[model samples]
Target chain A: MKNAERKRWCLEHAGEPLTPEDEAYLKEHPEVRLEVERLALMAKLMSLKNHEEPAPHLETRCIARVQERIQSRRERGWLYRLEDALTLNSAPVWAAAAALAVLGAGLWVTLHTPPDAGVAAVQEADPGMPPVSLAAVGDVQPSVVQTSPAVDVASADREIPLNEKPILFLRMESNQLPHNSDQLIYGNGGTMPVRFDY
Target chain B: MIDPHPPDAAGQAEEVTDQELVARAQGGDLEAYNELIRRHHRKIYAMVYNMTSNKEDAEDLTQDIFYKAYSVLNKFKGDASFYTWIYRIAVNRTINYVKRRNKRAGLSLDDVDLGIERDPAFLELSARESPFRECTLTELQEKLNKALMTLSEKHRTVVVLHDIQGIPHDEIAKLLNVSSGTVRSRLFYARKALQVELSEYAP
Candidate 1:
């Protein structure tokens, strides 16, 4: 409670107490004591804040509870630990790498294994002729070569970065082509090879 | 007379830096973890207790907050000191618990420290002609807590953090995911409402 401007300043900054100059000003201008009472209340509240304490041995009890929890966590099955690790860290790099590895292994097993597990024979390609799409020719239907020589360039070593990339060629006479382009189950196109990497 | 307390491992670990304690705790040293808890649990408890205005809820929540900090200790990057980090955890969880409950329970306040009688602020206020001058410490504590419980959890939290616990508004804003302006405004309004509420107890 001082000059209007100074009183206003003290009121606005309630968190802190008044300056000594302002106390002198307030004593001289006792009429504005109403304004200074608010600061007194704020100081009272600050005292309340400082004087309160929680129960004794709070940390000791809290540590006990935390210990019990950690023990239970340790006793949890591996699945719980896995979830704990996943949530505890931000997309851990090892986790990401493990997920990719699992997917890669799953895909490798899927591609290498034949469509029909009953198809006991692993597919083979004659070095002289084009390879068939093993995946496309799901059930290896034995067929008669209706025409003279060969057909679509079936497969090649496309994935391998070899110095002289090996290419397999199949040359069947034009009459032996499937009656409709859509009828060629394994052929990628009427003229193009049905490439196989597996 | 027999010694009431034996030698304690944490007594030794207490001398270690928070950085060392955190590193050891991360490396599966449990005593180091307990020492870290010892270092901070009072402030955390006081914070939650004031916000909830109930001893039991404060106890439960404080325990849960520490357990949470331990469970997720690996995530602590030391980007902030352990004190700030745990305060962040305590503030966030208590706010959430307060909201979820959506109401205050009976105040199970602790005894006002005996030192409050001799506190300069208490002496100064009691000396002045004010509402608190004639009230006993217990009566003042109850009225204060009751008034505090009247505030919205957000406002109460800001007051508890900034006014009571002495945390900076910037830290409170970070904890609440709001701007420093919001903390200030909430505190201003909260203190205003409280002044009115408690002074209603005046003789």
Candidate 2:
């Protein structure tokens, strides 16, 4: 073996006896032997360094932690499973990009679109129709009220006339009304001034 | 708590191959998984301790390594022995950890075990009239660990695996994902660096 190769082999196998061929090569070049001895001593000292036993609690702690992790993963439902699947190497970059794009577009539409656009669309579709207020459905013009003749006369008879103008009261229970009375206007022109009595 | 498995079955469990344990673990046997941890935690801890030179970090990293291995048990293809597979995870995780730790702060050494004084190699070295004898084995261990930290992570890893841990070059190559030639070259350079660093204690 060449000197450099022999030296490398000797350093690599520092504690081990040199092979016959390498030994002959080293004998031929005694300078490499000194280098080999130095490397061996270094390896010996490095090996002599104390082995650090982990704390006695390490195994139990590790097992407990691992068990906790496994339990947590088991408890996680499909959302985490989906996340794992999406994070897998098999999940292509385009799929993630597409998902992000869809989310971003949905958010953009939500933030930019006016909250009352649906109401405006309904009015635009029939410009002659009056806007119906859910809170005051009884206050709708008689003309709009005429569109729906199905209003039960008995309920209307008991209606408290909060405002005059031949009010047609639709007495609905307070719980029946939308949580946000301000946003609960019906789109159709068949408006009735609603009276909610708890 | 009653023993679910018979005594013979428990004996069989002890004798089961790693592949069998892995299969059982994959099938939701917590005991099998714990057995694997019991089998390999020390070696893994030692490897991490050597690389990081901090006991607390080593303990944390060892736990993390096992947790990661357990989490991804399904991904193991059975191509490599569980030992090799776990070692791969450990080596990779530790390398990344060492890199991140290097950016944050310098390496820190733990107090060397008092057992080093009774070690045969340590006794032999301390017997000689050398500068290293002036200090105790624990001090020598501290100095060695500090010197080890001076080498680059790559060099330190090779030295720790090959020289200290006594892993063969081929296995070191497999663990580090490098060629045997690269392992040898790294060992050579690492040893040379360590030699110069510890020249004061040279006999």
Top candidate on TM-score is 2
Cα RMSDs, all models: 12.8, 14.9
Task: Estimate, for each residue in A33-74, the C-alpha lDDT of model 2 and write its tens digit.
Answer: 778887877887888754555677878898888788667768
Tell me how far the alpha carbon of residue A58 in candidate 1 is from the true structure, in angstroms, after superposition.
Answer: 2.2
The residue-by-residue lDDT of candidate 1 on B29-101, one tens digit each, is 9998888777777777888888888888999888888888887899999987777788788877788788888
For candidate 2, list the clashing residue pairs, or say none. Answer: A136-A193, A137-A192, A137-A193, A137-A194, A138-A192, A138-A193, A138-A194, A139-A193
Compose the digit string of candidate 2's lDDT tens values, residues B1-203: 01123222345555887789999998989899998888777778888999888887888888888877886899998887777788788889898889878544545555567777788777777887889779865677778888899999999999888878878888888777799889988888998898889888764
The TM-score between candidate 2 and the true structure equals: 0.66
In model 2, how large is the Cα lDDT of residue A132?
34
CA error at residue A20 for candidate 2, angstroms: 2.7
| lDDT tens readout by residue for model 1, A72-177 | 7888867666766664443574678799999999999978964333212212323433333334423222332233135433333435422234333233454345
Q: What TM-scores does chain A show, candidate by candidate in order? A: 0.31, 0.40
Alpha-carbon TM-score of each model against the true structure: 0.62, 0.66
Candidate 1 displacement at residue B88 in angstroms: 0.5
